[model samples]
Target: MAKLEIVSPVTGSPRDVWASLRCAAEDAARDEPQLASQLNSVILSHDDLSGALSFQIARKLGDSELGAMTVREVALAAMQADPSIVRSAEADLLAVEERDPAIRSMLQPFLYFKGYQALQSWRVAHWLWEQGRDTLAFHFQSRISELFQVDIHPAAKIGSGVFVDHGTGIVIGETAVVGDEVSMLHAVTLGGTGAERGDRHPKIGRGVLLGAGAKVLGNIQIGDYAKVASGSVVLKPVPSGCTVAGVPARLVNCPTEAAPARTMDHTLADVVYDYVI
Candidate 1:
């Protein structure tokens, strides 16, 4: 990857993101001669972000039922119909580069990160779901899970600029709604506790941060800018701007960070806890 000067995910358009990505890919190819072909194939060859995304996803998800070309057509149709998917992809790519210190280039995430790839593929699956193509949508979902280990249902509505770190073992149930700029780590489950139907699963607000191994269950609301600490099992509603931790997660601190998702801070506040002998 090229020397990653600070790239803004919020300020630029998708076209800008594509340009930077191609620049970075060119630099990476030059830096590492062995990767030139892969870089050229994935980044330099494409005209825009959406075309690259469709090709990459199809290459990964294609199977006996749907070949790479057919899947590419499906993804391309969805992206062309609703351009928001590619826009969201751009946001997601920049979000990873912005939030994850490990990421130095947008090109790396756009080409290789399973989290970004999974989310973008899910966007196509989501479009399919919205069009009442449940079977094909589920096919995309299953392929995504099998390939990336991130299982987000097609019906789950996710917003833009979301950062999903590591992207392993993250399970988002049906009817779940994740707001814009939210960040979640590996092994996170936004699910329900009971079999009771209709609108089960959590509703995460904008700019919320869900730590690794966090389990937020039921149809409860996790308010905007709230932080769910790692390994915490949250069963009730979390107030906005608060931080919750532990089993049946309680408020560890109120008015934590204004935007914990962007900050990516997971440290608990200094507090004394009573323990009965």
Candidate 2:
């Protein structure tokens, strides 16, 4: 794991400069009283956003051997910043952790984690949603997905350990249930078939992997350890320990055929930006 350097607010300090203006960036709300008041109107919305950001930091710290900086400290750092500032911090931390090779070598999760980036996006969207600004939240989320190729619904329920590789065009339904150790790639869809009102969409099991362009619609149960191939549209219950492919995906192989998880290529040098809490 990479060493957690304690940055200082001032330069030329013995310890690393852990406290910088980057972490203390101000928000647009500072100049806009109406926006600030609007955000505060939501009960405890700021605190909720903080907690969500904290959760992502903790997940990123999973089992890493940092010298002293703990996940809690990351959350604390996030909390100290204004909500808008925290949003950028969360994105910076995620962008570095998820795609930066320099930091990847220093972090254990560089090779095997997913939820760090996903959760950060979710928290930002959730904060915006709470503030009654769904359009802005979704806009930010869409941009993240477009740039990172990792598509996660702003309203989806996601657990930790989600690895979304080549995430371009990945679509998660609003009513989807994602569990731990789940991995999906470009163009995968956990969506609904028709205009069903109540409880439409797939119910994904824990530790499942959906290949690129795989579409699982309706209220179907994709059992644990299930894998769906690219371009497959599943409308039936996929039993545990099975790999399904093609339209209306059916069981083709058993769980023993489950392949090892892989990481996505993050070599593109585009600027990655996300909304702050």
Candidate 3:
């Protein structure tokens, strides 16, 4: 596999990302002729990233209450109302291509990755929730859960450049705040310890990585650049740049890498018993 050229959000504009996506789509069409028409309609036909994303999201989230065309219009309106949506979408695409070893092209996530699709759909739902359209926002949430198997409450504030890989069984509570550039794997939960009222969920900091099946409960903070190892049940705050693992997660060691999230390095160093309680 060729090394992917990392494109920073600061360096790569939305147009550049869109162009790359279009080029990838063209290549995919050439390689797999049968999907040419689908690719063209879903990606090449659109004028911008928002249009393509809106179309794909709407098609996936559409239901009897709202048809695909209607949902598409709503999604488009949301994207137009806030240009940040498109920008965030681009950042997310870049993050996936950069971090995910399995991904070969920018077009792959746009067309097929359920994690990407679920997150974008949540964005629209969040917009609706912000506008006081609670019913409609909940509707989108239901469809996303049913279709994608990833349940993120409409009010959860998720930052840009987040990659929720193999998103199945992932649950984020309403008050959960996932910071920018965070990478979460399958079956991870940002949830409450119990039936609490307000601000019950965990607050994940920037560039954090929550490994597969990790359950972070309550209002504790997982500090920036932290790593929660796979299947760990975290109940307390984890300091920045530390690695935690176990049923009730404990600090195993301080990660040497500045941002383990970006590196996606799951391996831990020799356990520093001094740090463990």
Ranking by TM-score: 3, 1, 2
Identify the runs in model 1 with alpha carbons over 4 angstroms from their true place.
Answer: 1-15, 272-277
TM-score of each: 0.93, 0.52, 0.94
Clashing pairs in 3: none
Highest-TM-score candidate:
3
Q: How far out, in Å, is residue 11 in model 1?
A: 6.5
For all candidates in order, the CA lDDT equals: 0.88, 0.52, 0.88
How many clashes in candidate 1?
0
Give one digit per residue, the lDDT tens place, for model 3 in 56-112.
997898878899999998898898887777777888998898799898988888889
lDDT of 1 by residue, 236-276 (tens): 89889888888878887887868789879889778723121
Cα lDDT tens digits, model 2, 124-162, are 555555556678557646655654555656666665445
| Ten-residue stretch with the least lDDT total in model 3 | 1-10
Clashes of each: 0, 13, 0
In candidate 3, position 249 carries an lDDT of 83
